[model samples]
Target: MSVRRTVTVSITPEQDALLCAFLASGRYRSISEVMRSALRLLERDEAATLTAMRRPVAHDEASRG
Candidate 1:
């Protein structure tokens, strides 16, 4: 089984409303599911950014020799 932990978060009324709307739309079963999906997207974007930053510049490589 996977390990799980509980976390506390604070959000503005507007944000809460958005989460409620998502639930009402039937796309997500719970607020936690919505938050988890959002976090996964964020993780993917950050990983892509880090991968891009680690790539060598083609022009710089040509100037070396």
Candidate 2:
């Protein structure tokens, strides 16, 4: 139940080489797969950061109670 779109992005030669390396390793099937996996990691990291930021400190909780 998700919509997918094709996006064209410009990257430096070094970045392209990195992606090619991943492909050569036979770990990722294509550039899209590599990008998706990276995005998943980024999303997880951001979610964890946001959760930590929203968490209340023990001292703050004691003051409020």
Candidate 3:
């Protein structure tokens, strides 16, 4: 079974309206799906950022001599 959490957020009226449209169009089963997709996108972006940050240093860089 899948569990869920409650997350509250604020956004511009325009953004909220857009989400409503998505729901009304049946593009998503619930507002939760929209949020889930957004969070997954953020997770992917964060992982990419961490990987880039851990990339090897330049050849000119060296430890204290």
Candidate 4:
């Protein structure tokens, strides 16, 4: 089992409407599910960004001859 943490977030009215719309579509069971999925995607993107930043540039590698 995974541990869960409670967090407080503030969203704009538009964001709240969007979430409500998503819920109405029956795609997500709750706002928490939507947020969790979004956070997971964000984490994936951030990790990818960090990995890209740490990678050696092709031009720099060629200049080391």
- C-alpha lDDT of all candidate models, in order: 0.96, 0.97, 0.86, 0.95
Query: Ten-residue segment with the worst summed lDDT in candidate 3?
Result: 56-65
For residues 1-65, what per-residue lDDT tens digits would candidate 4 score against the true structure? 79988899999999999999989999999999999889899999999999999998999989997
In model 1, where is the ten-residue run with the lowest total lDDT? 1-10
Worst 10 residues of 4 by lDDT: 56-65
Q: Candidate 2 overall Cα lDDT vs. reference?
A: 0.97
Per-residue lDDT tens digits of candidate 2, residues 1-65? 68989999999999999999999999999999999999999999999999999998899889999
After superposing candidate 3, which stretches have Cα over 4 Å from the reference?
57-65
Scored by lDDT, the top model is 2
Q: What would the per-residue lDDT of candidate 3 be over residues 1-65, giving only the tens digit for each residue?
A: 68877878899999899889889998898888888888899999999999988987665366532
Q: Would you list the rank order by TM-score, best first?
A: 4, 2, 1, 3
TM-scores for every candidate against the unseen true structure: 0.77, 0.77, 0.67, 0.80
Q: What local lDDT does model 3 show for residue 49?
A: 96
lDDT, residue 9, candidate 3: 89
Q: Which stretches of candidate 4 lie over 4 Å from their true place?
A: 60-65
Off by over 4 Å in 1: 59-65
Task: Give the candidate order by descending lDDT.
Answer: 2, 1, 4, 3
Q: Which scores higher on TM-score, 3 or 4? A: 4
